[model samples]
Target chain A: MSKTIYIAGLGLIGGSLALAIRKAHPTYRILGYNRPEKSQQIARERGMVNDLTDDFASFAPLADIIILAVPIKQTILFLKELAQLDLKKGVIITDVGSTKQEIVAVAEVCFANREIDFIGGHPMAGSHKSGAIAADVSLFENAYYIFTPTQFTQERALTSLKDLFKGTGARYIEVAADEHDRVTSQISHFPHILATSLMLQTGDYAESHEHTKYFTAGGFRDMTRIAESEPDLWTSILLSNSRAVLDRIEEFKERLDEVAQLIFQKNEPAIWKFFNQGRAMRQAMEIHKKGGVDSFYDLFVEVPDEEDVVLKILELLRGISLVNLHINEENREDSHGVLQLTFKNAQDLATAEVIIKNNTDYHITIT
Target chain B: MSKTIYIAGLGLIGGSLALAIRKAHPTYRILGYNRPEKSQQIARERGMVNDLTDDFASFAPLADIIILAVPIKQTILFLKELAQLDLKKGVIITDVGSTKQEIVAVAEVCFANREIDFIGGHPMAGSHKSGAIAADVSLFENAYYIFTPTQFTQERALTSLKDLFKGTGARYIEVAADEHDRVTSQISHFPHILATSLMLQTGDYAESHEHTKYFTAGGFRDMTRIAESEPDLWTSILLSNSRAVLDRIEEFKERLDEVAQLIFQKNEPAIWKFFNQGRAMRQAMEIHKKGGVDSFYDLFVEVPDEEDVVLKILELLRGISLVNLHINEENREDSHGVLQLTFKNAQDLATAEVIIKNNTDYHITIT
Candidate 1:
């Protein structure tokens, strides 16, 4: 029998999940629910779902599995509404939210006397770009999919949910709801706030010193890139995970204040140790090998400024199975340029390095 | 008549300047001075300079131009020692340091009763990689070289120094020493500290939650990339510009604390306004063109995941006059990949985009 999977919120995650399941299981029927009716119509036109609905009451009883891919607040409201509905027995329900503790707590209350199984999930994979237009079947490939289940959750339902997501090529790890919220607050949410703060600080400085704006080079740009993130989405996240974010901020401020005091005292040894600690910690991050996520080895090659010379070098590399080649054009002048080549794996980079050494006289350095 | 130039400090900046000047003016004699004598010896073997000297007192009076390229503290000390030399009549003296006010002030006091001319200079070009091995002849080509001259500076001396650096193809800008320090502290020094603090915060978070380390993605990496910078170098910079750095930190903290309050109170309107402000300010930054400094236009193209398919697309682009091509390897899985092409100028990017549109069916987006 073909399973009926209902996905609420036809945005990037929901749309991509629907498409991935459709591609993998031709017989499974995917139904998408979203607001305004236009999004549902679009999702149908895009072939992301076999059916579309704006009303949840009619579809709640038909779904064997339900995935809520909305913001944290909306997901809570939807869980409350679903609790009032007569969902099928043994139905599996889950959510793709940035925070888990709040949502999982609500799920526990809503399903306390109900038959529906609720599990909180988060896929640690997404782009800055959002919406259905940016959706892809490969978004979750090799990504870590974290699941948080309550004591009331059934093992059969958890196993089935894992099997369903297996076709998306995600690695699964089960964690406690509170633990998921705390860890993500540290790694993802807190860093985002820092990026935004850095931008505002630089922007304030740029207002007085206009030339400083022009001097905002690669490092500054990279450090604050997340400042360009979606406002509505981030606001929802910040509000839902307020306690954890604020706690992390207080901890960060203490660390920064220590450095600030050291600078004021002109304490050279203390400052040296602080900087070395940061460097050592950053260098200790384990490089992910199999993920389609962000793990790359970069190689920089010095090339002459001539267009023909750079083209010739690319031509030579095109014959080899390398990953990506780009010119560091901003770092180039009229006489010299730097060519950056990226590889998904280290072996591919080694192979390209050998080929370049055997073929060209260009100086290459792996960064 | 050919001129002689003496450069103290054979690190990345000084060594590259020597090689660039040598390439442009073949007949000009260049002498390099560095400690331990081994660095100067290596520079000579690499053809960076004509002569190597460890004793600065014997060689300081022989050159028409003297360049002091060292850290901020060392640059000030060198100025005092150079002021004691009595042979030179009108030799133009300059030092390349990140902070300008202190160095320029020291130079004024040292050269008050002497015949030597002292001027402050800062070249706004550098790489994360340092040392003699990373030095190249074209490092300063099209880079911004700022000069701060005291009230006692001679017009003829300024003109002669400009003429000497013209061969290296650096664009010149004259500004007040205090103004340069203030602007650089805003854009460069403050951002470095923020990067370090973000890393420390994340490191603290990762200690208890080990799984959090694996979830650090592109945004986190980009924001903390400079955290891997040299400890001693950054220590010197933070201390030398401690006042400005601390001021900026206080200002930044005010803004961050405001946002944290809004998040705590669930002030949706205020949070929306703050995020929009950051986005607008980031969008308003002027894109730099025609510099050896970092600036590039990025174009993204969707391609199939096969190695041969990617190679074929690269081959097609190789036939075009594109400057740099890199693949977004972290974004690629078994079925989908995006290739990024970078161009030095806007015109070249448009040309390549048109060529790709005309020749292939690949979906392209200029980011």
Candidate 2:
């Protein structure tokens, strides 16, 4: 049996999802909807759409699964329009919105007493680059694809949706809609707002002072880099999750006060404990991006100002393939350097560790 | 006519400064003082000290300049001790403390109406490594070295201190002590506190929630990386600049509240304007600061994900040196991996570029 899946938006997220779905289920017809005259032929010619139509109300009824991958406001509008349209029985409808509470609420009301299953999704992956031209199959690869499944959502619909998105190679996680909204608010929405605020405050200070511009370090840069992201996009994200974002700010202010009070009282040990906890947590999550400590082994070797030390290490491990090695030139001296070695697998890492230990008397630390 | 300059505390910063100063002014007799035991013999054998002494008071009378390269607490203690029995005429004293206000205040009271001249200094750079052996001359190179000068600071003394530190290759910026503390509290001290707080809050959130561990992204990582810094050093810094830090937090809360209110009221255009202003300011200042960066040569090579490929490049560049090399782990699976090589100067990069091109059939780009 073949299925017709109508994807509403063909921008980066939607088009990428369309490609991933089409690739996963070759028999499923991916119906791409647009204004018909707006790049309709070009999108189909590029093979992103198996079938193209301008009439979503006419095409939505045929879609077994409907994906609303537009911006939040547009997605809400589409959900209302989708609610009014005649839809297929046992259809699974999902939207890839950053915040899920509003979308899930709208979805639940719209799909109530109907045969349709509404499951909210948030593919927690993004790029500064946007639009139809930026779509790619591997955009969601290795990323976390969250599904906010409410009590109204049918179990079988989620399974089918999961099967459909298997080609995306994203790790699937299921949670309540409110839980999803809260987490997104803490990690994404609140951080975005704080980054922007911090940047604005720092900028104002810099403008008023002479040569405060010279005091920036890599930390300042890292803290404020997200402030340069798309303003309109962030505004939508923050507003969509306004309640939770506001809660986060309130909680953050409390936490900030706790730390500031400690600083003001000169409670040195308490300050240390706070940062130490932060360090411990950050360290525990350091190898997370590379899929845990067992997967990627990092070996750091301090090499005294001597020629051919790094070359010798390379020679010893010539037969065994390693991941990466670097000398941080920014802090490196003309005579002294540190060799940072990384290995992909445990076996290779063990072999490299043994070889290095046996061959060199240099101080080595592994993390 | 070699003048004796006394250096106290030989840690990473102190040792590095000693190495740099000795390299620049070889004729200057660097008197190293300890109880004339411990690592005194080892440090002298390593050439970090020339003339050894058991008493700083005895050593103080013979020196033309004194450097307190110790921690903030230790530096302050030494400043008070030095004030009691300092006899050298026109002797300039300086310190390498992260926070300057407290140290300057102590020195102001200690050396008031005396022939001693004290100018506060802070080299805004650091590494995890500590102790005498961990020092590297290039640690301060390209880093910002700030001078906090006051009305009591003699112009000639300032010039002499600047001349001495000319070997560090750091960009010198002069500002008042209070101004220094204010700016540093905003950029360094406040951000450190906030990052640690953010991490702790997120960690608490993660602890309470199930499967929230998978929700982290690059932004989260960037915001929390500074939290991994040494807790004790940050504790001292925060306390030393507590007044300014508290003021900063007050100002930051106002800014954060402004953004939060805009978000809470769902003022779309106003929210957009806030972020837009942030983006513009961040962009403008990013360019303003980075405009001073020296040109570094970059070379990119596309390598297949085969065994021993990176090794081959390393082996080829064994004789030919490189400044930095990185395998962009993000897009490594884009059929082939690209190796990014950076060089401080053109000659080494040119040699490596030629060698890699001639040896491999992979696509190479030089920038």
Candidate 3:
């Protein structure tokens, strides 16, 4: 028996993982440890886990598996405390944090002679929303969950932990702690930094020119929505992952400057060509089959009279492969005997039109 | 009695406007004239307008409102031809194009005789998928429709046309043709260019590092979806709106450089403060009631058992002043429990999370 698993800091990422684990292994016992009475109450009320406790002594001793899903500073503090506490001898321990090298380094020093095993993990899943209330079981579905274990990491324990996340729809990848931080900084953290900058630029511009209110639309909204994320969390991410984030920011700046220089030269053709190259590269991205993760591509669509229409539209959309399709009849309706359809793909808009022209009286349009 | 309106180039925009006009004013005759025989056939078959024809000369003589809903190049050419044509006196000509200043400048020269007034109009409504086949009447609903006219523009004619556009769910705004182009270039064109560049960067990185395949998700997809937009249309937009687009691109690059410098210096606190400023600005923007033309803030949500749940949720959301909620449901319970709720404010996602927590049994989580 895998027995019960105890997760410290039952917040957004931690609570969500508990739900995911529950869904995948319904029979397994899951325990949560969090600060404040409300989070523990909400976790129990929401049935996010089987049990909750604030005491690390009692919780850590009876666990087959333990996960530290807390902030970097707190996670370090928790590791130090856990090093002194009485924990199950053969227990496997993991963590969910944005930065890995720092935490892993702390773990190495704290647990060197303590028989405690530490394997760092980072789930690429993120949202502007936060806290225990935001936790969902499907958060890790097919998301690229990475495990960073140092040379001293016990392979058997790491393998067992990896097995726990198997059916939770998260794909496991292994890398050095430093490399994980570096790669994620480039791909994830840097983008957030850039997105914040874009929003601030517009905000500064808006302060001076009142007319910006009338001008900025969907494009700006989508670009800046993530700007609303928690400030402290992002602060930690940037500070801890500064080196890698800065490197990627430089890469972005280089590209941006290239376009700026071309514009300064009044090279219209070159500018168009540059933008064209970007457009082509974007279009060529493999947007199909993201495998059950909470991907932005999973824009649920409402298409009325879905059964026949979905099949026909799917047939026409064979020209373009889509990652996932879920039909919601409530969001869509056949207005005046016209089947209204929505899709996640640009090509699907054309495909929907093709299907409508061939079969239904549906007025297919992209929203 | 308002006489028949003639729309040249019966493509998506023109055809849709013709349908909207007809729907809004059922008594008025809508005429569609296309140079392409196939498009003419499509227009007639789709009943896009009451009368469809290929002979522009014959139709031009009888038109009360002449809308140049054609390609930008052709729109200028037709304006020149209309300057010489023997048409109904006081016939107002309007255009539907992305860029306005160039067209208005050319129209100023073409229609030197203010008798045949050419007012530049752009309904910021379109789909990535377009053509005569995809044209529909309701495309302009709740969209931002702007009319850019010079000092010599006929005010009475502008009002008459505005009356015709009334009740189409499109709010009309007046702006200078040059200013319109400049502002949209920053808000619209620059974002598309930025998105394309970002996508290209991802592609280049992915080609070199296979690990990027796992990293790409919602944030990336939303950032790049517009990147996959019609390349040919973008080419035309970039070339025509070159000056404004280039200026905006430079502005974006400057901002990007600023952010890169901050990140490079590892200024974590500055990053947080800057991001928070943006967050507050974006949050304030959610107060706009009309939700603008590009459907920018009007994001729809779809979830299982979303109909009754979303309606009840909308009722709860109505108590909040920050967001405008619109929930469409006619079939009620007979309708599948799935609901599609469209929020006039993007910031409503945070609020909606609160509502979902209170009302829905189906676990609503975002991680």
Candidate 4:
């Protein structure tokens, strides 16, 4: 019989991974160890795994691989508990937590000479939305999966963990656990902290300016919208990765100060050069392998009120033979509407215009 | 015959306005004065206006409105030209620039006659792309259009200009040009400068780090994507709006310093509170009107390659239909590709899932 894979904490990351592994390796028996009854049911119903239960011990010894996908605090607690468990000598253990240095330190300090082997993993797949409700089997598809293999990390366990993610359509990158935390702190965590801080300052002044209500247009919303992320999760990440976060924060300060000084000196040429360099650099950076950066353009749409106008337009464009068309009604507002049409070439836009104008009386324009 | 409207520069903002004004006010004859011969041809071919010409003199005397949408430096130059021309008395003159204080100052210093009324106008509408090719009339449909009226401004001229923008489906706001510059420097101009500078720094670092290829995700992309905007234009804005931009840069520095101080002190509680405050304020803030703030979820789409697959899914979804659909053959990458489907609610999601799984062999998932 194939080994059973046990996923502790059946939330977005865990549940989604369960589903992804099941599809990729159908012969493997997947078990979910969920604390909440609702989470277990959600996991089972979503076809995340073959079985679900709360008894960790009964399955702990039987599991070939165990994935810990929980908060940083909870991860430490779970590691503490798992360290004392009677496990098979070669059992592989891994986690999907944002911060790794602290967790790796805890593992080394507490689980010395443990039968089970641990490897730190962080798949750079995230969304502002959380919980099992947001879980989808394909979340990790095409995303970069980082493996932080510490000096204490067992080689075989790391290989097994990488193989598991490889089956899920994820690309792998390896780094030191401490280095992982530091990199994310500079690139990810620090940006979140800076965004939140900017938001706080904007809020302090927002109360006094009513015109700011109208002024916070597309650019402002895009720049500051990340500020609305869950505070608890960010707080946890910041505390765990304080050193890295502070380092990036200081770096950002220096960059900002240079701009201030240039502006203060009234060096128009220097300021212009500064602005030009940034624009060129931003334009030149190659896109990452995963989903491109989140922009305000992704979040803003105007929805127009109408029930049948959409269907009428679709019928009008039936002759064009489009591969796909997407519309979202939940986020649609009362006065504006967004229609995203995919075309094989620029010629299709012309066909779309005629169809939209001919079938629907509402004004339809190409984006 | 209705009054003629003369637009300078014939770029995105100026050309789009000409197109929208012609559509909304059919009686109005629109004429474009583009510097480049190519721009005039493109604008005429795009039907952005009824007439496109290089002769500013031909239309200058007969115009009821003159919109100067050129670069700020050119704007001052154009003002000098308009100041010398035999222009109609009480003919309303307005501009569509990001910064207002500097332009307002120029108007006060140069055009002191008060005979040629200059109501400093700024329509807060922009796109990541640029030039006449990317111009669209609907870009400013729901955008905020502000008029910075100084002490010498006439009441009737201000009212007339407001009516003109109302015709273009824009809401008008009033503010002192200096105040407008200050507020925008904080919200709009400063963000642009910061985004560009950060991107430049990252780009500089990318040259050394092998992992630079993987860092462009989430907030980094969104924060820096705007940095990919037009360089010469941004450089001009920074030089023109130096004081206000510097003030904002200082404000951000102070905020960064406060966060850094707490980090050094290990004050987790204070840092957490600061993040929470930002989250709360961003959540409570309105989506439109003030600072380009908007809701975050409306921006992106997850699409697949097959047409029948998407249509089958849409067919299953009750009451939810597509507004437009096109198949882009040139843009296709994978064989069993994703299709973009937009739906109204949970029922639509459920119905679509059933159809997708039942009809197509490809796996279907909602983002």
Best by DockQ: 2
CAPRI quality of model 4: acceptable
Per-residue CA lDDT of model 3 for B267-310, tens digit only, reads 87777787787778777766223234335333344344332343
lDDT (0 to 1) per candidate: 0.78, 0.79, 0.69, 0.69
Q: Give a tens-digit lDDT track for model 4, residues A1-367.
A: 4667888888878877887787767888887788866777767777887877787656776689988888888888878888877877778888899898998888777667766778888877766546665576656766778888877777788877776766556778888887777667756787776677666666765676566555776766766766777777787888888887777777778888887787677677887788777766655555321242221111112336566545555555665555445554333324456655544334566766665666555555443
In model 1, pairs of residues that clash are A324-B327, A325-B325, A325-B326, A326-B325, A326-B326, A327-B324, A330-B293, A330-B294, A330-B295
lDDT string, candidate 3, A1-367, tens digits: 6578999988878888888777767788998898767668778877877878887667888888889998887888888888888888877888999899888988889888877788999887855446676676656765778999888888898888877776556778888888777766655666676567666666666665555667776666666666776777788888777777767767776777776676657565776677677666655656433422345222233344433444454444444434334333222223222333333334455664665567644444432
> Tens digit of lDDT per residue, candidate 2, span B258-312?
8888877889999999989999998888632441222246788888877667677
User: What C-alpha lDDT does candidate 1 achieve relative to the native structure?
Assistant: 0.78
At residue A144, what lDDT does model 3 achieve?
A: 79
**Chain A TM-score, structure 3:** 0.77
State the lDDT of candidate 2 residue by residue for A151-215, as single tens digits. 77779989988999998877798888888878877776788877788888788889877666778
What's model 3's lDDT at A281? 69
Ranking by TM-score: 1, 2, 4, 3
iRMSD for every model: 4.6, 5.0, 8.3, 7.1
All-Cα superposition RMSD per candidate: 5.3, 5.3, 8.4, 9.2
Tens-digit lDDT track for model 1 on A154-199? 9998998887777667779889988887877877787778877777
On the 0 to 100 scale, the lDDT of residue A301 in model 2 is: 80
